[model samples]
Target: MREDLTEQLSPAQIIERAEMSKAFRDVFALAGGKRVLFWMLEQCAIYTDAYTGENNSTNYALGLQSAGRKLIAKLDEIDPQFYPELLLAMKEIREADKAAAKSLAEKLEPEDDADIA
Candidate 1:
């Protein structure tokens, strides 16, 4: 049974299924491994400073994000799995939202007498 299950599941299929999962989809959809790790690090600093009563300044925030991006770049060079989906998701989400909004507006107003301003 174990052998049959192993034979049935290719590693790529397993990875894709895991990536498409509701919880993990956001992770894979965001960026690749190193970037994902860097985001986790940033979130940790935010929460940790909040708990420790450290003053969070604009400079500090900028520094943190800069560090994150730098780390992501370095990690990508070293490990080569950095996939950024933020821009792609931005386009997709905006298109989806536009379609939904258009549908709603049409439902609210008839085409012949609608004020399209």
Candidate 2:
């Protein structure tokens, strides 16, 4: 009979391992499990700061493009289906943020003199 190693870990321990482990490929493999995938999706869904009302999608994308490249690669190896879906979701958030920022900029722009005549 095989004993489950993860079963021996407390919730905090598991989270700590996930966040701090140097073996990210192994961690990503574990995270690719169905339940863990849902958890990761939930975390990735937070593309903005709720209290600050700040859009962080661009930052997230940059991180993924740079510092997170290894994580992305691991994700691709672990769960190929999720990689494109994650990119699509982030892209949607970024486009929405851009549109909102443009609308706000237009609103804040001074009216033309012709309009005041």
Candidate 3:
């Protein structure tokens, strides 16, 4: 019964794996949600003072940066025009995120007038 169960599940598992693989390939090939991908990579690649011989970033962050770089290279190979798209996307997202963060901070902070009393 165990052997039969394994046999029955193998084909379904194989198909599921193939479908997931194709789905991921299509996502990258079509550049769908690539802005989100760039955002994630940008977060991973943040090294602030790492370049200044400071151990500011944790080992986990450094590892993420290394892996993110390899993924970036693969993305570049997949789309020769990726760099320009990445540049534009990064700039737009950064500005939007910065504005959103500032707005949220303003809403969350106590009023200066209230504190002055």
Better of 2 and 3 by TM-score: 3
Candidate 2 residue runs with Cα over 4 Å from true position: 1-69
lDDT of each: 0.54, 0.57, 0.66
Per-candidate Cα RMSD to the true structure, in Å, reads: 11.7, 13.6, 10.3
Candidate 2 lDDT by residue in tens digits, 1-117: 113777898999878766654454444344244335434544554333334334585666544345345555566654576567655555655678799999999999998989776
List, in order, the clash count of every candidate structure.
0, 0, 0
Misplaced by over 4 Å in model 3 are 1-32, 46-58, 93-117
Ranking by lDDT: 3, 2, 1
What shift in Å separates residue 117 of candidate 2 from its native position after superposition?
A: 3.2
Candidate 1 C-alpha lDDT tens digits along 18-56: 554444434544535324554565563532433324556
CA displacement after TM-score superposition, residue 52 of candidate 1 (Å): 25
Worst 10 residues of 1 by lDDT: 44-53
By TM-score, who's the top model here? Answer: 3
For residues 1-117, write the lDDT of model 3, one tens digit per residue: 745654777787868855755654566444436676666677766434235355554566687778777767766644656656767766777788799999999999987896685
Candidate 2 TM-score versus the reference: 0.38
Model with the higher TM-score, candidate 1 or 2: 2
